[model samples]
Target: MAKFTDHDDYIAAAPEQFRPLLGQLRSRLAEVLPDADELIVYDMPGFGFGKSIIAGYAAFSKQCGLYVSNAAITAHADEIVAAGLKFTKTGLTFSPRHPIPDELVTKLALASRRELGV
Candidate 1:
């Protein structure tokens, strides 16, 4: 794994095909969490509010992820499924072929901010 100094470094280090998707995710998250601090934790890019990371995103070999609080995942599980995306307890994964919707990203970020009380 590459050691990333910041979000730009992480995105630059990702595979070529995923760069644009990662960029889009980063922008959407930033738009929704303008007051949140940009963060790099566990080598992933995230947005922090208060002491907690409100949202994080990553580009893996096969997919990209949007990570938020568990409550946010639970709250939007149906939308995720409806969009034909896959998700874990705290994140959703999508490939370029099936990108995450912008509206869903906003909802998840907002939900995470509210749930985390940040």
Candidate 2:
């Protein structure tokens, strides 16, 4: 993976097909977490709150991922499955053909911020 100095660098370096998706995710996260500091954590773009990286995102070869606290994931697992998306304990993976909804992103980001108590 290429070294990214910031979110713009990471999004610019991503595959052409995923750039728009990454941009949309970034916008949604920023909208929901206006007070959170934007930063790079674990090589991915993340929103930092109360000394913790509460949310993050990354683009891979065929998909992009939105990562939040495990509590957020568990709380929204049913909705995630209903949306026909796949997820791990802390990440939801999606592609252009099956993009994650902006509403869901907002919910997850808010939940993450709440978890951080910030």
Candidate 3:
């Protein structure tokens, strides 16, 4: 729906279907990087830890794009390619209709910590 540049803005603009999912993602990111400076940049929910960017969450046309801003997934591109996952250098292109990869998300969260020095 509408674009939001902060959490409260997101809460107000986000669609109902995406709310719970976004909340879960937000909580997960928070738990993973408690010391990070969480902000809503680029109209998406993003977390900034030190000079590093941990991750961000967004509801797209038909999927929720879970973004690891530091290009952490780039390092695993080959593995992702072999696994048949469609992703870019920034984030995994996943459908919200399907289940989220909690395990991989966890790994990315940890990587965010390292990248951000958190």
Per-residue alpha-carbon lDDT of model 3 for 16-103, expressed as tens digits? 7777777777777777778778886666778884445678877765667777745578666675555556777678765546535566
Best-to-worst ranking by lDDT: 1, 2, 3
Clashes of 3: 0
- What overall lDDT goes with each candidate model? 0.92, 0.88, 0.69
Best model per TM-score: 1
In the range 2-33, model 2's lDDT, one tens digit per residue, is: 67789999999999999999998898888888
User: Which ten-residue region of model 3 has the weakest summed lDDT?
Assistant: 94-103
Best-matching candidate per lDDT:
1
Error of 3 at 21 (Å): 1.4
Rank by TM-score, highest first.
1, 2, 3
Root-mean-square deviation of every model: 1.0, 1.2, 3.0
lDDT of 2 at 60: 90
Over 4 Å off, model 1: none
TM-score computed on alpha carbons, candidate 1: 0.96
lDDT of 1 by residue, 1-118 (tens): 7888889999999989999999999999889999888898888899995458999999888998999999999999999999999999999999889999999999999999999998
